[model samples]
Target: MSADEKGDFISNNHQVQPIQNSLLPIQHNPNDALPSSSNPRRNPRNMQGLLKFLLETTKNEDGTHDSEFSPMDEERKEFLMNVFESMSVNIAEKLTESLKVISQAVNITQQDDPSDCENALEVLTDLVDEVDVANDFMKIGGLQACKPCLYSPHNGIRWRAAQLVGECAQNNPLFQHNAVQLTFLDDLIKLVDTDTDERVRVKALYAISTIMRGNEKAINFFHDIDACHTLMRALQSDSDRLKIKVAFLLSTAFSGDQFLKIQLQKMGFITLLVQLIMEALEGKKITSLEHLLGALISLSKDLPDALEDCRQPNLNFLNILDNIIQTYKDDSACLETVSYASSIKQMVYSYTDVINADR
Candidate 1:
């Protein structure tokens, strides 16, 4: 914000609250695994010496297995790495192969075997999850290979392509910067605006937020556009996944910049968020309400003056907080909702105190 509007106005904020970077977990069905004719649990030795070799790696230096050991330990990594290599499917090797396969698939029968493309995409998504692998991915033209899939008619392929970009760029400044150079920002924005598939839209926005989060040029580029309105439409969307992500992205986008918060407040973001919260509470379920509440707390944190929007008597912010706390307190799943609700309740209390002191 210190820079001129036409100049570089955004950069990294090391103090920005860390986003919980995660992909929607791929639910690997046991049936999806490559199966064998013999059941290993019934009898270990039936499948040759493979089972014994696995157990041998777990043996400690004293020749007794460390029953409490976890895979995170260095010894386990060194011992188990050979087992992974022997399986002939090292992740880097297979993931590189998959990148080529998808590129070729897109060039060939894109429609004939969507499952093959989708499966290959899912495999590459694994590469994006790890930083080192993500680097290797970019070095080998992973982004260009993925571009064709982004336009695939299959919804699964499109969403997975977006997810690949989002996962690779999250919390990674170098990747974020490169994503901008490759014009991923423009493509992702267009994807969010026009994609009919809700999953695709959500992942596209996820990638956009990550790319714009800390990079100066990317954020400056976005500043000239209707970024707030794009977010507003997302909040008004029917997809709970989209709304939750948009809410979290608010914090990421607004942090370390009062000018941005002022822009949001002017754009009626506060009023819209209140309406969304009330709608979620008045309905039968409030699963995604937690993120909405967190957004409010983030946007209003440490403000010199409480928002006039929050002080509206008709909105009754305190009552809403109380209802959320009471309803979600005992519900195990909404525990985060309760905590965020409590934080905002205290925020509202502080707001009220400031209002009364002025009176």
Candidate 2:
């Protein structure tokens, strides 16, 4: 089924029905001709008249009410769809007006009133939601709309935008190219390094992880651009959230193509990867430990190359593999670890056979 049909089906299934007989016709209210003494300062008659007019206008021409309501509802839904479609090309323009209104309100309040910040937050949130709606309509365009919000003046806005970007990047590998082309990495790195808001920085780190995950080109690009050091620095940030995100990114990169992995290892990434795993083990940051272990397993798959690059003998690598096998011999909780150990053993044994044959 088409996306629109699916959306409509879901909407119809989840929609709440309006209360029966709740809509009173306009111009037929008993209080239209009466005046209230309790509210001398208020104009109750005028209010009643206005509500009556609205009710009457909403009624069908055939004297049967709600006959036209479904068509009107469908029209409104179509208009909303159009608005979402136009969001990509017109987001910057629409946001300009919204930002201006927010800034004007903030200026009037002079930052003295909490309500000013609340209003700004509300507008910013609506803007982000609109962008997300657009993304659901057209993925790439919606991502573009959210890109500028990463630099928004309000920390809350920046954090939300960063999250949206990461979510978009995670959904499509093509978004990885768009993200990098938009210099998303530069913005995220700056946020990671200089942003005073820890939440914003943490979210930026997550965006980095999302952009890198399952994206070989992005990993190669980062390796070629020598951004691994900056990424590693983020792993050392005080925020455990940022550290975990950075570790995941690194682990993903390490598990990519051998060329990218070798490039990163040549740039001294293996040491950082090992250090991160050790730190995670010690600090109980088990969130990405399995991913890290999988990355290490991939690295171990090419043990001969790593040994040669590090100028170490194959015997040394075998000894490390032996230790791991012994440690996870009967540990049920470490099933993944045991599987990795078995793979490492196989790689070592294969290498030894080849070496002896050459000799």
Candidate 3:
């Protein structure tokens, strides 16, 4: 099925891709001692031992590293990745036990150390990124374990927790559905509404975006929570990071829902999207042009159908879409694909035929 047709699809190129790179930086070191033939670390039998050592080393005993982990030095994170990658299957198999330790470090019920939780989330996020552990993670109550951290007093802890949840929800429909069932998305929306920290808000918005991705049920749940208004407020933020993420969320959620398309246009999202594009054209903010265009394209394709039953349409996004396509045709080749040009071209002709038939 095409991306737009899938029930749980998010573009492979969206900000979710960055979460893979955001948590870990793995580069083999020439002087590292873990890979030697005689190195005990090479033994897969020692994987669980390695995991325990990591947890002990990272736990904060006296707030010495409340702001960060002194033990999680570059050498340590690299070593952790090295060992974890070597035994991903075994670790995932033992994920329930491993989660006990990992969760204790982060779970507010088990620990209150923000630094420990932050560090634990970092490690867990990196692991989830490396493997399809969403089911295993959720199976072991990971969703419940991580939920409290979203409101942690520490910005880093909250940020990392939010990032981890979003990564888990990526491309996993069941996980997304479970997240909604557990009201995780509502908590995240509440984070967006109340968090004073921009970093935390951005992460929360990104997670909501991921959980809502292409799941029609989740998207409907989003409306039930009145998240569209929350997203609109985010779109007006001065932070381009927030704007790009919320715009991309709209694009992903807009892919398969016809009802949402009408609701979104009624909220004036099409005009806001066009304004974002115009800002990019004027070189005011260049970071989100591709995502903004993607959202506009999704909207363009839906507007005609969304408003087909209206007695008198209030606006002509088709005309606006035609101008956008013409204006950006030359630059479209530089985007992720030329499909935007072709898709909009087809939309223009389709709308033209409908209008001519009426005339």
Instruction: Give the higher-lDDT candidate: 1 or 2.
Output: 1
TM-score of each: 0.72, 0.52, 0.63
Q: Rate the local accuracy (lDDT) of all candidates.
A: 0.70, 0.55, 0.64
In the range 17-88, model 3's lDDT, one tens digit per residue, is: 121212233443434344343664442234445555556554556665456435557965777677666544
Quickly count the clashes in candidate 1: 0
Q: List the residue pairs that clash in candidate 2.
A: none
Model 2 misplacement above 4 A: 1-148, 152-154, 173-177, 196-198, 213-217, 236-240, 282-285, 299-303, 307-333, 341-359
The better candidate by lDDT, 1 or 3, is 1
TM-score pick, better of 1 and 3 = 1
Q: What C-alpha lDDT does candidate 1 achieve relative to the native structure?
A: 0.70
Best by lDDT: 1
Evaluated against the true structure, the overall lDDT of model 2 is: 0.55
Quote the positional error of residue 264 for candidate 1 in Å.
1.2
Global lDDT for candidate 3? 0.64
* Residue lDDT tens for model 2, 167-266: 6566455556667766788888788878989899888888887777776666665654446666667666666677666656655655657776666566
